[model samples]
Target: MNQLTVFEQREVLGKEFRMYGTPEQPLFLAKDVAEWIEHSNSSVMLSKVDEDEKILMLNNVYNQVSTHGGVRKEQWFLTEDGLYEVLMQSRKPIAKEFKKEVKTILKQIRMTGGYIPVSAEESDEEFLARALVVAQRTLSKKDEIIRMKDKQLEEQAPKVEAFAHFIENEESSVEFKILAANLGIGKNELLSILRNHRVLMTDEYMCYDKTLGKRVKRYGAKHNVPYAKYDRFFEVKQYPTDKINRVKVLVRPKGQEFIRKSLVKHGYIQERAA
Candidate 1:
């Protein structure tokens, strides 16, 4: 909710430059950068930069920059890439140090939200110590971001568990013989028990056969599954065949667990610990 200032006057090394835009995407006044690198009039060396990297902005937009003389109708600003390209043009010995100061000042703005120029009288040791602080702060920001992500995943834990429960209790299922194969048991043995108990059924019906073009009698594999507890253990589904439709009883994950428990209790199989 805090607003960021559009213009900042930063003293980099012994020279000064006016910075614009946010710390993450900083831009510089092309004229200031042009003079700092000692490009004295042969077009100020700014014209050497590629057209795409240099941009023209309305002076009135960043009013803080033009308070004294009022902003120009239009002024040139160098993009981050453009600034670097211009720095590489200067053959002056001080150009190398100027580049370093520009880099460090921008980094300080990003990490600390402000810049503290090196004091003219400060020892070399003091400068290094200050630079170290900036590096440490950047690392701390990265760690904070990682922790926030971990907390988000923790908050979503219950929703993920609920979805897994729904698969087991409702949607997940397999056909009768497929279930038998998955359970590593004999299909006919399980079929015989269910039929004898009247828990499942089969019947014969006739319908138009698409292949033979006639009504032919066919044995319905599953006429229907007689519900003992309202499909808690199994669901009856009718789906299309090549020529017609057929019924199938699908056993769910919950039903599979129930049957496995029953088999163990009856001594038909050993209880498998999972």
Candidate 2:
């Protein structure tokens, strides 16, 4: 929390506890929470908290608490949910009061967007307790707009990364199976889709192979022929060695994008999990 400094302490609240986190989502020092809840071992108390709810901060030369100093080298802070979990797990009599106090403070801070009200009768300790909330009331309109835009970008990060991945590949040509994998579709499934959309045809017709002078059956290769929109996107190579003398389809990089969009429009492409 960008806490309102009590007695000129930014990270510490009235020397009672240390806070770390944005005023919007305040976090507490694990040791302080443990001591308040009467947990004998801070390490043991934190073991029950989820990994995502806890973060470790290490002391460094840049921070006021230098590594060369005799101070503890590391600290563990708990998220609001984690703090609540620890309080509920504690059997101490003060745990209930501590939970209620923290909940009330958090509620006020969140409701007011990190600018909580102070009461005339508020004690020094009570004021410090609510100090975890940052006062954002003075933020400029431009900064607020930037913050909202940043939040939107954060929410769209997964989609942005996916599109980047799709567009950044340098491969000039990709085999059908490999292209299908990149598109998150099975090889056979993609082949079926192509056939269903008439992008591929498998009708057997008589054709003369150079190796075999006589007439031989060959499957249709519409994607390699004219009048097809996606025809240029595909490279169909005739394999005359096989009895059927079938064609193997390969996709160019631009063709991959075209096929991807087409498949997406036809509801055939598999969506990757965000």
Candidate 3:
């Protein structure tokens, strides 16, 4: 048998396990597995096993490999069955989660063909080409995951905005229409007042570049150039109704404060005792 080489390491719940062996048969270090289980649950002890039984198990499955520096190292490795026995014998509750993690690692190793070993029949160029293909596939998988996360964020934006509005207005009972009527102003005028005070934001627009004959689109607030220079090249786009409604000034407590202060200053309502 070839000297065991660590091909993969995975951290599960803060404990680490290393996968070693060739693509045909994968083995895990028994000592590392025991340490991981003990770290996960301090109560379960591997030392309870009889010394003779432990020696017998090690003698049947362990490997002693010679290193290039004239050093011989003895490493105890476990097969799937051996690992199952070790985990099942433990009385810790975390043993179940550890078993599941082990299963996941085994599945991944099988799916990825465990570890790639350089064969005597294959040249260096061929091995490099195979490794390059695996790397490209891994990168593509990562890109797919990122795209999924972005889509999830886009879908949840409106809900998150609505939740924030609920939290801000949780203590206030005033509605938009009721507040406008109380202030003796139209709803649009109330919104305009808040916008003027920087308590509310205006609808966003998309800016384009007609001079370059290219659609270099930019968001209203994110545009780098002055709007006066590109006013003619921009297209007015209303913000999404759901997002607008969620972030409306009348629905926010701070907007109510601004309205109250403005009304008191303009004599719409008599100033109350401070």
**Highest-TM-score candidate:** 1
Model 2: residues >4 Å from true position, as ranges?
A: 1-18, 59-72, 113-274
TM-score of every candidate: 0.38, 0.37, 0.32
Local distance difference test scores for all models: 0.62, 0.60, 0.51
| Cα lDDT tens digits for candidate 1, 74-184 | 356787888888877778877788778778878867766556676899999998788777668656865775685466446544534443354455557877676555544
Which candidate, 1 or 3, has the higher lDDT? Answer: 1
Question: What value does the lDDT take at residue 222 in candidate 2?
Answer: 47
TM-score of 3: 0.32
lDDT of 1: 0.62
Candidate 3 achieves a global lDDT of 0.51
lDDT of 2 by residue, 90-137 (tens): 887778777776666567555654535578999988876665434433
Clash counts for the predictions, in order: 0, 1, 0
* Residue pairs in clash, model 1: none
